[model samples]
Target chain A: MSSIIISENDFLKFKEYFYRKTGMLFEDSKRYFVDKRLIERIEATESDNFRSYFNTLRFEASGDELQQLVNAMTVNETYFFREEYQFKCLVNSMLDEITHKKKDNSPIRIWSVPSASGEEPYSIAIYLLEHWSGIDKWDVEIMSSDIDTKIVAQAKRGHYSPRSVMNLSKPILDKYFIPQGGGYQICEDLRQAVEFSRVNIMEPADVRTFRNIDVIFCRNLLIYFDDTSRRQAAEMFFDSMKAGGFICLGHSESMSRISSLFRVRKFPEAIVYQKPLEAL
Target chain B: MAFIKKQTSQVINEDERKTPRDFNGLCVELNHEDSKVRRWAVRDLAEQLNASSVLVTRLEHEDDASVRTAILNALAKLGDTIAMNGLVACLRSEEAALRNEAIEILKELPYEVEPIIDGLLTDADSDVRIFAVNILESLRHQHVEQWLIGVIEKDPHVNVCSTALDLLSEVGSELAIPAIEKLKARFPDEPYVCFSADLALKRIEEGSR
Candidate 1:
């Protein structure tokens, strides 16, 4: 029951600032939703008004408040086959092109980062099994990483809440998962198929070992990083990739905003970025 | 299963990492014949506090775009006086890409860049002044609108004022309205300025209401 009111100008200020900091843009339709969250954060941070809260959000050295705001604003929940079109892109377009262009029969490598409890890497495995015909022909390496050790451990455990697996059809669920602790436990094969490691993508040492990657699913994570970190992340990925490798960002995130190193590649399933074939 | 595990333990062979890894070795490698070797040296150099001046020197001669990027990131990581001044020097470089790269790094270092921004704005080089305004375009400092107002109010170059005015359109407020109105009169013959200033003025008036 505080009397803090967000004026029209205040909302505009917050909207532009938030969009610039994080790539996520809130439309006019999300105004009520945005304002409510802003008020909640205002109250939580004990700021006198929107202006003070915004100042701290922008200038706070630790950047905890901005991170908190990103978490509150973004729907960060991950599930099986989330943004599955990119998987379709993988099976239909990316893998085919990769296998064809590859001179040697080296394993095609795929990296999924911010493993976020393994749904994505697991989903990639499941998608290749269910949809990709070349799964039988080519050797594929799937590596998944997360900044949080706890999340990395959780990802390796391969357990999922009911909500996490809600997108999976019952038949696929039955085939790939077992009921455990009133939740779904991913089968041993899928878990073993992926190599999960703890990695802070920002730390060069953590990511230096991930090299020659072919397709990278780095969705929904860069939106949380500040501008410099995002560019550095792009640079790290650029170095990690082989020439002509593909990168799939979150639907909202674009390499165009981050750096000019990658080329925009449009596929029927989803648009992706590519390290130019000529780049060393 | 076609899906393999633990297959990539980096492609870099242990024997290939034979470059001397100490600070002096990295400085020498920064001038190595291979661009990749030089890039790796830049990355490793970024970890050392004393490496900034060397990085600044290497960045001067590093022609490869990727190597330049690594050097820029390393300098930004150091975030010291030498690092900041080196980036400012890039702002005056004849190469457009180098200038743009410097702007990108400067935009992220508000605390480091804040002390130098006023001097940059008032610098004799109009293009350098324009680049300074470009840094202000995304600079998160609280005084961005004010700095931009100063440019529009005093910076004699039309293109520089016009650049400041363009950014002012997005971030300007009632405080900027007077300066922007005077800018329109100051550049009476400049059609683009008059139009955008009116547009910014209208938006501010509407937004404040």
Candidate 2:
């Protein structure tokens, strides 16, 4: 009849277990945040205490509860200029370096996967147009994909609610979008700039065509996958990239934890991972 | 030429076949000179339920790391008995990279690897037995604690027992307490084994209360 209390011991136990499983560590300051979610999960699962719920989380054959806990713990949102520093790095540091090594007039390729509601791909288009000087000198192709055809369709539509574009400046918005129905419809240039496709990165057939990509923003997607899936995804991305091409993950996600393929490159704007220039 | 609008997505349409994609053809591509061709062959072969036996043969000689990784992923995706056996063979590989990669892949395969884990734990090589305990660290099965207990209780090698004992301190409960005590007694002279077993016991006691 009573709710369970998460003791200090339980907190320590769960913290270590969660960190090992998900590679996300909770500091003492995050105790309230972690415990609130743990108790919520315990209650939701109808388990009397943290022990039973944790046992279910740890040993559940289907691993569904662990995924549920992951969903509860992580924030999933999409917006223009979300983690804007990475985009700044893309324009200031990454693209310049990519172009410096260029020997031909081939177009630069950028991929934003899980094109969630179109914020990320369109944001990349805006960044290159407004921030990068090389946009006029070099041709760029921005291609985005998501596993869900519905989301891919929504992305191609190039429409966004106000919250999705809250981070954009007035000039950037004016230059790129038209105010429509209290929201914004991205201009035809930015919409047509990105090629949207339905792609499951996990499937070999789906990803085989994604060859010679120059930059990839695979932010926050690998966290949901199991270790094998994560490694497989990394392998697929490695094959997809041009030698020395860069990848940007969510700030909290580390490529080192997922795979040994990529070399970590520390730029002033952000840290990104790079495929080796002479990789075989 | 900035943002050149393509009339159609060429990538989606044009995947030129370097080799025929039939079952037998994919198998032959495994021996292809170009590693990328071989890698694609491995990826496509993952769809074939019977590709494991063909893949296992290539795992031994695949020299390119990327291509080898693709083979490992395909093998693990199949995860049938033959595939699992091929992975177990990798534990004995001369290359540490391949062996460690095999361990990581095996950790992903709780169901297929479960029946063979006991044999791995009792493998003739002490190093292989130690690797088996390492697999238990992330098996995500209820039997992991029991497997660790079995290692500490029956494994003759001190290092193997020590590896499992270190894990038990984290995952074991009161069920493992008695074995923890006996393990400390079993290796009275080995400092790490004694310390780890005691730590496991203390943690178990605190946890149970």
Candidate 3:
């Protein structure tokens, strides 16, 4: 079988189908990425061009092929402490706000949407354990999710490469991780703190399940979205957060044009948004 | 000779002495007939003498856009006036990617490159204009604050307008107060315009306080 050459028409068809099915719009620039990912499917199925490969995906024997397609399409680059200042704010100021707003010893729920390989949610878990006292008394839950099943499986393993562990401070590393052969495995305590699941942010079921989250760390994921999709995602984020809860974004991402629901907060090195208590 | 030190190796030879000059000679091998050799030389030169006037002068005229981009980036990293004309010439390139990269480099320079950047504000490419606005915002070049305010007042792109508004709020220039107030008066229904204007007013008020 020869390698399939992806044409513009095939790219458009895939883009339109994906958008219609999942509400995740892919722009014209992602043509290269789509071509690269789908060629593997074409090679595996011994089909030429994206049209036959896409047909195989639609009518495959097992559902796993479609899952692989979604997995290939989803972008999942993340690291622990990806945005340092936002985490600092969470540790320093946002914790106080969360504590003040919650009833004494009530469970504080946090979600890391598109959690990738689980570095982000685990980072939050470590933060909570280190800073917040009476952790056992407070029913703390960290819900970590990603659209890719493979990454979700990896996330559940709670293992990481040395490079991924770079952002983790020495103290945190020593406290929360155990030395595995080459990479470190998250200690049982941190691993148990989060519930890992495969969840596409564009799926209605996934969004509905992530309700009443006290804080959301959905950073860096919005840049891929078009304007309408971004607005829809913003609305979903707004719905997900509890009253007075915070939403941390990537350093470059801003809610300025997309949503008025979030009130932007300025810290020295970071910007975040808060869903107003009054609005809630 | 002043920069070089005498080695105490017992096996001193003429070829070894000539090796330094050979490496220097390979600098011209950068222009060798082989594309691979020329490419490697260009990359090596870019890494070694990023801002050296001689390297910058030579590489700025390279046929390859990738090579020219590397040169522009190296020049920006050096932040010297010697590379300014080359950077300025790049801003007018037909390629949006090249022009955008040049604008990004100019924005990083400490000196006021606002006049050049401000000219790009009206470029047909929205990304170029947006990046130019971002650079001005980062620099807090108050001279261009009015230009930004004009963007907020009149630019068709909401993202550009919002970016300008956000920057103006951050800079908290008193001159922008009227523009913000005017935007508020005209676009009362648009939540972003109102929100940005209010934030700017709040910032100005807080500054006075």
Candidate 4:
């Protein structure tokens, strides 16, 4: 056990610095959680106290420690096929329509923004391969990105705990993953299918790197951002996609609240946003 | 398939089976003379478990524009790459609407359309090269600077080089200053290339500063 304590002023300093860096707002309700996570790092590094740790975070030349802190503080709760219906809609209708109009050999592109671990995008690959027989005939590019460099690195490792894959069917599990130690490691083929990178959606330059996306899966990420940052992210996605491209938010998130640029589309399985065909 | 866990002595059950879809009737409706029926059939096939093959085969011969669009959309939803060939061909379409539609799809497929766009960049038709440059302008990629610099240095078409310089003005860094200088040296006679190169050079210098 360690005896690291965080003062109120030091906590506020961390809050402000974190918000400035990642646009993730920490409210009063999350004080205990944030304080504890920060203290863990202070003790691990043998720092004097929270104030000194704050100084290191703010003035540090390298962003590596700050990223580790982000990995510690943020909640990366996700699983394969967490929202099966959204993927169902993706395979059932969206790809069909996009491929129908495509007469050339251009591939269809999908983005899983803040893809957390590799589960979501790997799930996407597995689902598409299983449900869509025409998958191999079309060039399909899947990009999975997250702001937390640690998590992105973990995603690239393609390892998952048992809980992260509970929602996956046994056949999918057996076919795509091999049990490793107590955890499961994704197969090489499925792992290679998704390209993983780090991106902060709040930053315009970062988001600008992703383009011409047909479908975007930004589930459960916006809820962590403030209203202003949320609006910026929505605008970024709107600008990043093609006219008539689809966006799937978390079950609790609504495009109506984020931005009015996207039209709400109701499918039999899920409700998503679409950049209208007329949109430039 | 059933797997028995030796340690736990438990048999993991396979997934619950789904009801089979009527792909045959949907296939028949796809060939209906009425474009409306064909369109509806295309949408219906998208709902089936394994109608992608039926949709891909029908898409090749479908004549009605509306039905063809429906089939394309359906095939896209099915995640078939067969529609890509047709969509790429549309980039060369003389019809403005068809060409615009194709560009829309191609623009959304940055990674997949790179090769096709590369082919167009050096096409004999300067208009095609301009179109390729315009598409590259909107896309975001790590190698965009490299591609733009290549065009500015080597492409003989002033319009294409100007387009590349315009994009460089937005995304370029100090690394692009030399490329802009080279463009200026390459086409001293072209006023627009020189002007755009000046603007790009200024932007890159200001950014680096």
The candidate scoring highest on TM-score is 2
lDDT against the true structure, each candidate: 0.87, 0.87, 0.65, 0.70
Correct interface contacts retained, every candidate:
0.46, 0.45, 0.00, 0.00
Residue-wise lDDT of candidate 3 within A1-280, one digit each (tens)? 4446766655655676566334456777877777887887778667765655665654343435655666677765677777667767876777667877786564577788787888988887776667656354556667878889998899989899998999888898898888898999998766666787777776645665566677888886775664335655775676567768889876546775455557887766467888777521
For residues B124-204, what per-residue lDDT tens digits would candidate 1 score against the true structure?
A: 999999999999877768888899999999999999999999888777768999999899999999999999999888767
State the number of backbone clashes in model 3.
0
Q: Candidate 1: which docking quality band? A: acceptable
Off by over 4 Å in 1: A1-13, A46-64, B7-11, B14-16, B169-178, B189-209
* Global lDDT of model 2: 0.87
TM-score list, all predictions: 0.90, 0.93, 0.43, 0.44
In angstroms, the error of model 1 at B24 is 3.3
The CAPRI quality class of candidate 4 comes to incorrect
- Every model's DockQ: 0.45, 0.47, 0.01, 0.01
Candidate 3's C-alpha runs over 4 A off are: A1-77, A134-137, B1-209
lDDT of 4 by residue, A20-138 (tens): 45556789889999988999988776778765565455434344467678778776678888889999999998888778867677557789988787888988888888888668678
Best of the two (1, 3) by TM-score: 1
Identify the superior model by DockQ, candidate 1 or candidate 3: 1
Measured over all alpha carbons after superposition, the RMSD of each candidate to the real structure, in angstroms, is 2.8, 2.3, 26.8, 18.4
Tens digit of per-residue lDDT, candidate 4, span B1-209: 01111112223231111223267777777777766456657756766657767776785576655455555555444543555556655556676644554454454455555566667777788777777776664343455667777778789888888888887776666777887898899899989888888877765554443
Q: For every candidate, how close is chain A to the native chain A in TM-score?
A: 0.94, 0.96, 0.69, 0.73
Residue pairs that clash (backbone atoms under 3 angstroms), model 3: none
Q: Identify the superior model by DockQ, candidate 2 or candidate 3.
A: 2
- Sorted by lDDT (best first), the order is 1, 2, 4, 3
Query: Of the candidates shown, which would achieve the greatest DockQ relative to the real structure?
Result: 2
